[model samples]
Target: MTFQWDAIWGALPVLLEGAKLTLWISILGLLGGVVIGLVAGFARAYGGFFSNRLALVFIELIRGTPIMVQVMFIYFALPLMVPVRIDPFGAAVVTIMINSGAYIAEITRGAVLSINRGFREAGLALGLSGRDTLRYVIAPLAFRRMIPALGNQWIVSIKDTSLFIVIGVAELTRQGQEVIAGNFRAMEVWTAVAVIYLIITLALSYTLRRIEGRLKIL
Candidate 1:
């Protein structure tokens, strides 16, 4: 089939609307995920026996399962079991947050554990509480160290928004499908969608590298 270049331009507006939601879901999810990861990571690193074990179980359960299944359970199954009903957008964002938190926790934990014990000892020697030592010293260093892993997860989280289409969140991929259905221009619509995603990812990669470089200088 002959491809029409203009058809891509025609689809941009529709796709951008969908992409907005994609960004919304990704940003909110990542924000929440970072908080969860940091807290859980700290627990695993220093919360002692039971807290560490609990964090490990939560992370493992999330990482081991498919994200789609998780979203489905939250959106469909949970309502059946409890007085809860999350719309597709809420479900999608929550799913990404949960999924991203698991991986981010592992990344945070690894970064924290890799730090020299002497640093913590020094902070303690300075009359600082363990919490203060972590907050004022180790946490900052570990976050800087984990920049690459967090950036990687940021991209993964963005791309994963496409999966929310299965639950009818009307994200980028779903928008493309709707356009294709109306026009029957599968190649053009899908190609445009793919290009849009590539652009977003590339822009994100560039921004992340800039942040990473800035952190390295600090």
Candidate 2:
């Protein structure tokens, strides 16, 4: 079969608009995930019994479940449980945030734990409080070490945005589906979608690698 450049070009504008929504969801989700991960990570690393247990439960719950199931639950079950109503886009974003946060929390915990104990001891000997020591000494080193893992998470989160398609969010994959339905050219439409996703993912990976290299030098 011959390649169809015109078809691909015709789909670009629609895909680009969908890509924007994908980006927005990923960005907001990553932000939310980071906040939750930071708190949960710190709690597991340093907080007392109640906090640690809560974090543990959260991590287990999210990590054990499928992300698709989580998304469906959030979109379908949440409204039944609570008075608030979340639209498809909002539900999808919330799902991404909660799902990604669990993995990120583990990443953060592992990074912090991998830091040398000697640094903590030295900081304590130098009269820094526990919080201050972590803030000034531990967190910096841990964050640097975590860059590679965090980069992996960022890519995962971006791809995970595709799951939002189930909820009727007009993300990249959803747009591709719509285009394919209209033209009845599944091969051309899907190939274009795959290429687009690959391009975005590769670009993100390249940028993250550069950032990781810079962090290593510090």
Top-lDDT structure, candidate number: 1
lDDT of 1 by residue, 1-218 (tens): 89987778888899999999898999999999998898788889889899899999989999999998999999999999999889999999899889999899999999999889999999999999989999998988998999989999989998999988889998999999998888888999998899889999999999989999999723
lDDT of 2 by residue, 51-157 (tens): 99999999999999998999899888988999988998998789888988898899889988988899999999999998999999999999888888877887888
Taken over the whole model, the C-alpha lDDT of each candidate is 0.91, 0.88
Clash pairs (backbone) in predicted model 1: none
The lDDT, on a scale of 0 to 1, for candidate 1 is 0.91
**Least lDDT summed over 10 consecutive residues: which range in candidate 2?**
209-218
Native-to-model Cα distance after best TM-score fit, residue 170 in candidate 1, in Å: 1.3
TM-score of each: 0.97, 0.96
Q: List the candidate 1 regions with Cα displacement exceeding 4 Å.
A: none
- C-alpha lDDT (0 to 100) for residue 63 of candidate 1: 98
For every candidate in turn, the CA RMSD to the true structure comes to: 1.2, 1.3
TM-score for candidate 1, please give it: 0.97
